[model samples]
Target: MDKLEAKNRIAELVQLLNKYGHEYYVLDQPSVPDAEYDQKMQELQRLEAKFPALVSTASPTQRVGGEPLDKFQKVEHHVPMLSLGNAFNEADLRAFDRRVTQLAAEPVVYICELKIDGLAIALTYENGTFVRGSTRGDGRVGEDITSNLRTIRSIPLTIQEKRSIEVRGEAFMPHHSFLALNKGREEKGEMVFANPRNAAAGSLRQLDPKVAASRNLDIFLFGYGKWEADSLPSHSERLKYLAALGFKINPEWKRCTTIDEVIEYVSYWSTERPNLSYEIDGIVIKVDDLQQQEKLGFTAKNPRWAIAYKFPATEAVTKLRTIELSVGRTGVVTPTAILDPVQIAGSTVQRASLHNEDLIKEMDIRIGDTVVLKKAGDIIPKVVRVIEEKRTGDEVEFSMPKQCPSCNSELAHLEDEVALRCLNPNCPAQLKEGLIHFVSRDAMNIDGLGEKVIEQLFQAKLIKTIADLYRLKKEELLKLDRMGEKSVQNILNAIEASKSNSLEKLLFGLGIRHIGAKAAQTLAAHFHTMDELCEATYEDFIAIDEIGEKMADSIVQFFSEEKVIELLQHLSTMDVNMTYLGPTQSQMTAIFSNQTIVLTGKMESFTRSEAKKLVEANGGSVTSSVSKNTDIVIAGEAAGSKYKKAQELNIPIWDEQKFKEAIES
Candidate 1:
């Protein structure tokens, strides 16, 4: 074939291969045989090799994987990926429904979806082409894992529409994939992962994308983060739109008009969760109408419009071998139950959290006694209760230590908290834990500075304070065991890169008591500079929304410390960035300012999200429902109940063309 013909054939093969792969992986229906798919893929690869410049990023051959990354870069989310509050039982779900009704002041419609037991990820598309994919780290910032995400055949490399958008989803491993992976690991005599969720997370985090590709991973797009198009007011409509755009959305989502239907959905899913090919820890219930979600807003950590109804945890019996104590960064002494290895759920259970001494006494959990263990949220393992009937008289009672295990400092029990705390600020254990937090992904984001590396540096006395990290030399890092020249350089480079991070990162890394990541972002944005933040009083902090009295006091108290002041000075000398660089909220002033508009039916000229954006750009808000307060309702072809309601309320209505002209004019 000629060069041009080869290019054309490559394109055809790429499309065919992608279609066949998607059909098999996502639709679970293969129209073409595997041999035909393989033949096309092989042809595409050969053509791409002959004409390297013609190879596209979206080509099916590219999914084989690329060179390993030294580290994943941090990506800032345009829209915060908020977590959901939990509902343990029927009462909790009912309470959630009541709260939604009271807030919305209308009968609520809900969309119930299986809360996939997997890693939460955000995929960004620019002009229909996948640009980036990231882990949902602390909501605001995430680790860029685009290479790994590309390997998932179900995830489209390009969409049907050419638009900029961000979609959120759960990337998971199927039960079969998990079993096969673990069986392979067992045969290879390697450590097996605990569950499908863990296996998926671990696979996605691989430095090499080829490793991730080998592990069969799939994704179910749940919602959009940002859709730069016309708006769809209902959540269900959005799902349909995403599917139309060539995204794989979970088909199990159901729209329920009332709380009773939601409850029924939840109850049915609770029993059916295990029967599915993939794991589902809970059912997510969300208000179907986008307007209700907007009106409900969000709490500090979660959305008020949605709640997750968690299934009861899977349980297993095991013998408690011993009790171990560990100190946290806050100096809280926590008890951990060391158990005789037993398989529970999908993984082996060797240890479970005891929570505190009070819990130990309440449960009468003695060492050498048989105990029932369960995973809380299918992630954290905890002792449910002691299997008293199975226990013998030889069981030994456990006790909480009076002193800190690591620092030998006297432990103090606070009146308000259950866990005993080590009040010594100079404790080595606290410093180590603080260092670990400082270099964490959401904090300083210093890649290659994991817990093991941090522990090694601390033990070697190469690093004493957070500021000491900036003073480390390449030679010093080389002294550590297993530290290669390349690894040391990477660590040094990460430390240097972290210096340019926004003030929020530094604030969170400081390990300030009562100040979480979100609060740090709020404070950073408000103050703009660390110097301004340091000078702010308790009143200044309290004035900010979401900054409570305790957090305010902690901020003021943290800044007041001489050591903290010294640390800040040293960091400033190192030329670390102290200002916020994220997008700031700007005031809107336009023709549609403060107007409540409702769009209904089909638009010939613009997509739903596009129309919504046009209205918002002109300073108007688009709502899902037609209410008495609605100022204008845009009716398109086959306008439905919203159109009739707007007419009854004597609200102004505009056709699709008229609406377009108004926005344009």
Candidate 2:
């Protein structure tokens, strides 16, 4: 075939493959065999190879395309996609009901639906055509994944309504599909996906849209990201609207008038969940009324209008073969229960964390005892309960060791805390863990230094302390496997670049016990330099609001350590910047102090983000859309529904030029 004809043929085949994929994955139905799909894909690959320039990211053959990304980019969410508060039992459900009644007063109804075990995504449509989709990254933001989402068969490429809307939902791989895929992988000697949720997440993260398409993914629309237009009256009505507009809504949804009804729905699903084609961990209960939802509002990281009623803990009985202890970087000894291989929550379970000595003692867990294990939140397997009747007399009870497992240092127990800790300054395990934490993304954000790389570096004896990482040479790095000259240079460059990071990064990088990123930032902003921070007394640190006595003591104790002092000196010698950037010593200034502004639609003159920056620069806070609280709403051309919402809210609205003029004025 000629170049043009081959391109046309490839497009046709991609459409055919996508259709088959949708049928197989989304609908749980197949129109063609795997052999047929593979045949078409291979044919497309051949054409693409022959005409390399014609190769596109959306091509069917390009799923799982390119190498794995070094890092996921930060995407600020258009509207904060807050998580739902969890309701563990009927009492919790009743408490939620009480809270809703206190807030809404009059008769209230709840939208009860199956809580799908999958990755959450936000889908944005413009002029009834799907344009963008993103992962619920940090709730405030998510990764842009428009291409990957387009591959899902259940996600309509175009809606009949010619209006913009943002819909949020769970993208899932059904249990049956997951099993079939895993079976195929097992036959091919490839690594099987741990669970359906994992399979869906991994598939969606693929860089190539074609690879994502091949995975036969599906979605069930649940909520709106930022609703455009006010046509839908209630939450239930919106779901119906989405369904009418060609989006798939889970059929298991129900409208519950009382907490008892919600509990009934949850209980029914707890047993029925296992028998379903797709995996559902719990039932999601949300307020059905849109106006009530608005009045109910949200908390810091969760919505007050909705809550997830999780099913009773799913547990699998497994034999505890042995007990082992691992000494962490902080010299905390955590006992692990080595178990006979079993499956629980869709993954093979071999070991479970015993957490600390108290947990082991509380449960009286012994080697050779039959224990019930579970994976909570789909990660971290833990022993839930012991089947004492199943335990043989030969079972051996374990005790917490007096000495550190790694360095043989004496362990010490603290007040209020359960875990015994090794306070030894020279503990090797603590040093290694400290090094790992120091180089972690939220700390120094040094690229190419993951857990595996840290382990290898420690084993190679190239890094003895956090300071040793700064001293690593490019030539030495090149000696490691998979480390080409370019890779080596990248690592070296990243390490060098880390030296110039903000004081907050360095403060967090120090890995002081009980001090998190936010605490570190606050401390750094309070003290201009590391030297000032180190010299500050516990009382001085505690004087700051939010810096409690415990945190102050931890900070004082950490800075007072001779080894930490030496480490800091070494870092200083390595030419690390230890000073402030944003506000200097003299400035008693607060820039961008509270003024409310709302942003709407696409802008031609300036990007939405850029406009927000301009607003912040002149002391104004830019919100997602308009409301009564909005001091001003910056509306660009084709602002659509948010523009209308602004009008309804009676918020002051301005065009792009007027917004610019106002900012300057």
Candidate 3:
């Protein structure tokens, strides 16, 4: 094609790509299949290559992420991304209504939107073309992530109108996408990001927008950052204008004239949130009129014009009856508390993790001790406490096993540690546990090989170790209980597929004590080859950042064992990707830096680990109590005494939404 024709095609493709991106990313729906999108993108790239002058940096083809950035360039938000105040329940919501009514010159209307559980970012469009994007750093200066931001198919590469607009929205990895990404990362030995929020932030912060582009990150525009074109009088009207500008605005937002309607919207989503592919912590309530918002003005951090009504947490109580100890693949004993059958949130609960022996002693828990059980965020189950009043003299104190329960090997405890480990590499418990970890969703991610299948294999003597899994015969698998030819083939395919997994995943799958997915990635990157890592000393391993002394020692000791060396050889013959999987580092450090957080009660928005991950991503610490040292206590429903403790201590307490905003900030 001629230069003029190429230029025109590039512009047209850019516009079309932006439209498709909006339909897919902004909306929870997609109009075109991925193949169709890629076809058009490739055509645009080819045309641009033929005519370099036509390749404007803003073109859709320019969105492929790049190399590691030294640092993210700071961008001052044209309009500050103001924080929202919070209301815990319908009562507090009505109180907010009462307060707003008292302060208002007239009856006010409210607009409510689902508060998305994701990273907050500011998008800038100059002369109708998307230019830069940044995190909501301190609500003012944020790191520039323009290239990575453009990879979000929903983020309009260029606005239809020639107005300079700053848009405020959420950059989130959808739950489904998060699961898939984590699964893929796990197989490669990369550290799986703790939650979608961390995944999204880590993806966007990549200096190479190409990496971000591949992550399938998405965004939803919630409010106008700063706009000066044709003036919009109300917040609700601006939302409509944004939708008209080909920007994706949340479809669930409602213009509620009464407090009852607001309540209805909040109620609908509290139960409905689970059905969505992404996560929302609460609902955002804003005055419909921008003029009213101006009048309401601000507090120290939050906007008076807006308040977030949080959903009640999904938690229920069950009695802890007994504590059972299970040996991990690394032979570390982890305590699992058996509970009286009870319904919690949406599932049946019979067990909760007691974490370790120290935790059991710290909680002063014993068998026959009635304890409160909690599934924080409706995902992980944990024993909250021992009901000391119900304790009988028959109550038994729990102890860590002195030997491997499966193989009768002697157990040892490292100095200054709580985990009791069985050092025998050939321990049956360790083999079974290691195989489980190896095929875990965060590791090899073989779909059909769950615990039951593994147990059956163990019983049949078909697999003794993780490497044995790679050598399973189809005929043998089909002979097992509930195994069909189709199922056996599928399992075989998955096992074969796992051979391509990166090195870090294999390290984590090895079940070395204290070596989590993150630590695995750190070790893989630092050592590059499995052979090199196995030879490293504790001091050498400890030199890596975030690698604590205990973890370093665990790695060194794991490698020193002859049985482990044999296992590594078997895995090497299988051809796994034994290196870093994605961009090795992030531009934005953990957001919740140095602040301790305690999440109590039922968290409606995110699970306990998911919440902890959010805190960790933002440079904050997550703890288990309300203390003067605690920065924020994220209190949820049926909070019991922790809420009272937080209030009593005057610790900065945040309901779900406030906590979300605190992390985003």
lDDT of each: 0.86, 0.79, 0.77
Better of 2 and 3 by TM-score: 2
Total residue pair clashes for candidate 1: 8
lDDT of 2 by residue, 1-665 (tens): 88889888877876687667656644567888899988988888888888888875546455434444444555677887766666778898999899998999888999999988899999888887676789886466578877677767678665668889889999998766787788888887566887788899998888766667667777899998777668677889988888788688898899988888888888888777767878887888899998899899885335789888777657888899999888777778889999998866666788888998788889889989999888785577899899999866999989988998888988999787798898886788888888888898778989988777888899889998888999898888888776799878888889999999988889988888788776776687778799999889989998987599889999999898898899899989999989865443244232335768878765645777568756754556667756677777777643545665676687777766676666555
lDDT over C-alpha atoms for residue 617 of model 1: 54
Superior candidate under lDDT, 1 versus 2:
1
- Give each prediction's root-mean-square deviation over alpha carbons: 12.3, 9.5, 13.0
Error of 2 at 456 (Å): 0.9
TM per prediction: 0.56, 0.66, 0.57
Clashes of 2: 4
lDDT string, candidate 1, 1-665, tens digits: 88899888888887788778778877889999888888777778788888998999889878765899999989989998766777778998998999999999988899999999899999999998999999987566789999999999999998888899999999999988998998999887566888888899999999999999999999999998987757688999999999888889999999998889999998898777657888888899999999889999985446889988877778878889999998899999899999988755556679888989999999998999988888874568888888788866999998888888988889998768988999999889899999999999778989999887888999999888999999999988887788899999999999999999988889999999988776776788788898899899989889986699988988898899999999999999999988987644353237687899999875646767668756765668789999999999997643545765787698888876577677666
Query: How far does residue 497 in candidate 1 sit from its true spot (Å)?
Result: 17
